[model samples]
Structures are given as structure tokens and as C-alpha cells.
Target: MINRTVIVGRLVADPELRYTPNGIASCKFRVAVNRPFKNEGEQQADFISCVAWRKQAENLANFMKKGNLIGLEGRIQTGSYEGQDGKKIYTTDVVADSIQFLEPRNSTGSTQNTPNYQSSTNTGGMYQGSSQGQYGGNTQPNYSRVDEDPFANSKGPIEVSEDDLPFD
Candidate 1:
């Protein structure tokens, strides 16, 4: 049997983190996912219950809060327990294997001190060039800081050799 699910949505509320008797960390939260279709010119969203464990759970509780955007990959879990009324209460939730923050830490407009974390899955090659210095320093020169283009004074077409071509 195969059971997998992926969701990208905003959190409904802050994650609730707790430790078990064994000292294992766990967190429970809800995500509000907007439906693609609209009904009566109004968009509807589904509140999905989710749970995360261990370091992921800790990270979620510490760094994420209500109204934050997030993406998660997990599997559906279902269980039932006896309620106080002597009735079985069925429960369903997504067991989060990985949770990703979908926005910058400062975007929420809060002045709290928090580390700026970017999704490693989509860094846009920010750390690609070099292994030295902070954030994988780029080997390329600081061209963006230049006030004017170096080629702006050139009077004619620049000449290039066939050997300079990177590809055919």
C-alpha cells in the first residue's frame, strides 16, 4: 500500500509542542489549505490536522507560528479512541516527515529575534559557487555594485574568439 500526501498552506495557529514520557518531542498543528475552486464567488479552505516529531517538531514549534506559510510532505494516519460519552472518536491526521518554511523570517513584520532561514530545497543557487566565506561566497566579481557597465564606453562590437565560446 502506498500513502503519500503533500500540502502547501498557511498555518492556522502556532504549533503545540510537547515531550513524551520518553523525552521524545512532538508537535501538533493545523494548516489552512485553500481549495482551487471557488463557490459562490467565495474561496474555501480546509483545515488539515498535522503532526511532526523529533527535530522537525521542535523546529516547527520554535520557528513557525500562526499565519506562516509552509509546505509539508507526509502520510495520512487514522485512529480511533473511546470518548467520554462511550463512543468511538475517529481521528485523522497527516504525519509530517518533512516541514519547510515558505517565507522569510522577517516578512511577518514581527520584531522578534529569529534566524533567517531559507528553504534548502529552493535556494536558487545562492550557495553554488564557492565553499569558502559565509553563504558560499561567489567567485564572480561584485558587478551589481558597479555604477556603470564596463562595456558602455565601447565604440564597436566586441570581438570574441571561437575558443571563448562555452558551447557550440
Candidate 2:
């Protein structure tokens, strides 16, 4: 079974963040994902729920706002519980593993409200304007296969027994 999912959308509203009993930070927000097909010249959108934890949650609360575009990758989870109205409420949301800012914030456009993201891996501590400072080099890891034989295994894709796999 495969449970992977990816979505790119805009936030429907400001995120609401709270701390768990153990003091772990968590945030919940909704993103409006537009439908691929147009209906009667109108574009449809689906409101998706997203959750972030720890440092990501804090950054999301501080940086994101309504109408800001975001890219999220996570799995979909569904559950039900009794609500305040004494009714069982079924809910579905993405348990986010990664979240990235897809666009810039308007407030931080001016010098008075400068963007506060940490400089890339270079430029010391000076503010990075517009291009956001590429710094010295790209932040993503270099994936050069220096090994002579990258895949020397005889088998291609794994087809293991039921006991060897986690999913049925």
C-alpha cells in the first residue's frame, strides 16, 4: 500500500497554533487547492487541512498568512470524535512532513517590515534583499553518484514476502 500525497495550495485563513500538554508545538491550518477542471467558467477549490509540528509549526505561524501559497507533502489521515455539539465529527487532514513558502509576504515588502528569513549559507548576517541571497551556493545536497557501480544488485524492484513488508 502507498500512502504518499503532495499538494500545492493557498492558505484559507491564518493558522492556529497551540502547545500540547507535553509542550510540543502544533499548528492547524486550511489550504484552498484549486480543481484542475473548470466548471461553467468557474474554478473550483477544495479546502484541505494541514498540521505542522515543532519548529515548522512556529515558522508557519510567524510567516504564513491568508492567501499565501504553500507547498506541502504528507499523508492523509481520517478519524472521528465527538464534538462540542455531541455529534461525531469525521475529519481528514494531512500530517505534514515538509512545508515550504511558495510566495512572498506583502507586509515584508517594505524596508520597515523587512523579511526575516535566515541568510542562506553565506553573507554573514546582512539582510538579503529580493533574490533572498543565494549566498555562496545552493542549499540542497549534491547527489553525485561517485561510485563505479551505483546499483550492482541482481534484483530490480523488491517483491518481498508479506512478513518482510510493513504494509499488507
TM-scores of all models?
Answer: 0.66, 0.63
**Candidate 2 on 46-65: residue-level lDDT in tens?**
99897876667777888888
Best by TM-score: 1
Write out the backbone clash pairs for model 2: none
**TM-score of model number 1:** 0.66
Q: How many clashes does the backbone of model 1 have?
A: 0
Q: What are the per-residue Cα lDDT tens digits for candidate 1 across 7-105?
A: 988889989999978676778999999999999999999999998766678888888888888888777889899999999999999977567777665
Evaluated at residue 88, the lDDT of candidate 1 is 98
Instruction: lDDT for model 2, please.
Output: 0.67
Give the Å error, residue 163, model 1.
20
Model 1 segments more than 4 A misplaced? 109-168
Clashes of each: 0, 0
